[model samples]
Target: MQIGSIQLAPGAALAPMAGFTDAACRRMAARHGAVYTVSEMVSAKALTFGDKKSAQLIANGETLAPYGVQLFGAEPETMERAAALIGGYAFDFIDINMGCPAPKITAGGAGSRLLLEPERCGAIVAAVVKESGGRPVTVKMRTGWDAQHITAAEAAKACEAAGAAAIAVHGRTREQMYTPGTVDPAAIAAVKAAVKVPVVANGDIESAQDALDLLEATGCDGVMVGRAALGDPWLFGEIRAALAGQPLPPRPTLRQKMEALRTQIYEMCEEKGEWTAMPQARSQALYYMKGLKGAAALRRACCELQHFEDVDRLIEKVYAAGNR
Candidate 1:
């Protein structure tokens, strides 16, 4: 598959998730077989002013190549300026975030709120495309602000006209806020039918069956793995295998899972200081540790970890437990 000028393998891609999907997390996802990954949501205002923290959010930490950075904002000018500033970066695409439902973002008239005004959303996409030098522009958005709005089909057409290379639609309204049982696959189908660009379906996809069902149901170009991939990057491999009609890979052993978690911890440490990285790594490690024997105790120990060595100690403890 291709996103405008960028070439991509035809399979599952990692969704840009905030508080997750950072450089280390993206690496983890890629290592496990996700064909693509998008950086966490970045503030256009911060990038426009050269904010170091925001810049770090999009920095290419790996030479692995082909990752995209997602930017969020409502104003066309500021969005264009932000894209222009980062146009020379090594990323493969500049993705616009029009689907975030967080109050912090929607209150600012960014994210999913953009669906409320389809025309303006198109203009923002056009501005970013114009200022992004030759980089392809993409978008990720929800079905709409609410059931009453249900405007993803309309917004999708606008994005296509504005030159978006592809669009990803999360099948929920802002009112659902990711609540289970609220995803409407029909909405994803609507967006796909309304656009020529690739449309990726996202929302409550937990297993290979779910991914396959969404693909056959909506006929979307691709599927994005979101929260379901937390601590479990292996989902991508499983999804990829399922897409290919191949046998699913075996589930990872506990020691192997711990090692992957260790790799993630070190990656985070290299990107951020131990203090900052530990908290972030611990959270992700907890996800990895979920459902394990003595996982609760191990998680508490992870909470107090102040150094990298602590992670090793926890790994050993997990190894010795052996389901005891």
Candidate 2:
């Protein structure tokens, strides 16, 4: 699948998850064969105002090429400025975040709130395109504000008309949050049919079969995986293999999973410093151990650890026990 000049080998793309899709995680996903990986959403206002933290979040583009930076804001000018500022950098694509259902974002009339004002959304897309200087611009959107306002198709059309290179449709209304039974394949199909640009289907794609089912059901050009990617970076490789009609690889052994978790935590500490990385590592370590025997006890140990050595020791003990 090609988005502008960037060509992605057909498979899964990583959703721009906040507080999680950082440089190390994105690079891991890319290395595991995720066709594309987006940076966590950065504030348009923060980018324009030269907020150091927001700028840092978008700084490491070389690590994940075909990299996309997702930005959010309601104002066209701020969004335009952010596009220009970020475009001047080495990013492969710029994505407008219109799917975020967070109340803070919606209260500011950004994110999914833009769906209710398609005209304004179009204007924002147009401004970002002009600022992007030929780099591809994409939009990620939810099904709609609610069931009463299933406007993804309409908003998708407006975005395409305003120069978006692609559209990613999450198959749920803003009101659905992350609930099961909320993902409507028909809504994804509607958005795909409404535009000539590529449509990437998202939502509830937790396994290789789910990814295949989403593509077959929606006829979308690609699929994006979000929550499922947590603790499971190899999912991209699985999806890639599935799309190529290959047999699935055996699940990682407990020891292998522990090794991957140790590597990820070490890298996070190296990149973000020990103090800042530990809390996040604790959360991720727990995610990595999900479904394992004695996981609750292991998670508590991980959460209380003060240093990387402690993490390494915990992982060693867990693997030894699993082997026994």
Candidate 3:
């Protein structure tokens, strides 16, 4: 699939999930076979003001290419400045965040709130594209603000008109949040039909079959995997295999999962120091241990540890449990 001139191999993409799609996670996902991965959303206003943390979030990872950076804000000037600054960096694409439903973001007139202001959304896209200097500009958005306002089709058209290289549609309204239900495939297909650019479908794609079903239902160019990628970076490889008409590989054993977790934590420690990385690994460690027989005990033990060595030891203990 091609977003603008950027060609992405068929299969899975790592959705830009907050707190989970950091540099370490992106590198791991890429290494495990994700064709593309996006950085966590950064604040456009903060980036324009030179916020160090926001700038740091957009830093390039050595092993992760086709790096996409997502930025959020209401003001066109702020979005434009952010696009200009990021254009000078080593990013592969710039994505405007129009899908975030967080109240704080909406209260600030940003994120999914842009759905209500299509004209301003178009202007912001135009400003970012102009400042991008030919770098591909993409938009991630929701179905609408609510059931009464299904604006994704219109927003997709507006984004395409404003020069968006691609669009990712999450088939749920801001009010739906993350509820469990059937995604609106018609809404996604409508957006795909409304746009000239490639459209990527997102939402509830947790398995290889789910990916295939979404692609078929929406007639989308690609699928982005979010929560499902959480302890399972190998999901991308599985999706890739499925798309190639190959047999799916066997699921990893608990021992293998623990080993992967250990390797991930060690690599993160090497990159960010034990002090910083150990704490960051807590949630991921829980994710890795999720389905194990004694997972609750293991998660508690791992989460209580303050050092990499402790994490390694806990993983070793878990691995000793065998297939049970």
> Backbone clashes per model, in order?
0, 0, 0
Instruction: Give per-model TM-scores.
Output: 0.96, 0.96, 0.95
| Best-matching candidate per lDDT | 1
lDDT tens readout by residue for model 2, 114-220: 99998888899999999998889999999999999999999999999999999999999999988997899999999999999999999999999999999999999
- Decoy 3 TM-score against native: 0.95
Return the lDDT, model 3, position 98: 93
Q: Identify the runs in model 2 with alpha carbons over 4 angstroms from their true place.
A: 61-65, 320-324
Off by over 4 Å in 3: 320-324
Point out the higher-scoring one by lDDT: 1 or 3. 1
Ranking by lDDT: 1, 2, 3
Task: Please give the lDDT score for candidate 3.
Answer: 0.86
lDDT of 1 by residue, 1-324 (tens): 789977777678999987788888998889888888999899999988879888888876774637989999999999999998987677889999999998999999999999999998899999999988888899999999997999999999999999999999999999889798888989999999999999999998999989999999899999998988988999998998999899999998776787898898888888888877887777787788777778778888777777899989888777766753
TM-score of 2: 0.96
Q: By TM-score, is 1 or 3 better?
A: 1
lDDT of candidates 1 onward, in order: 0.88, 0.88, 0.86
> With candidate 1 superimposed using the best TM-score fit, by how many Å does residue 320's alpha carbon deviate from the native?
4.2
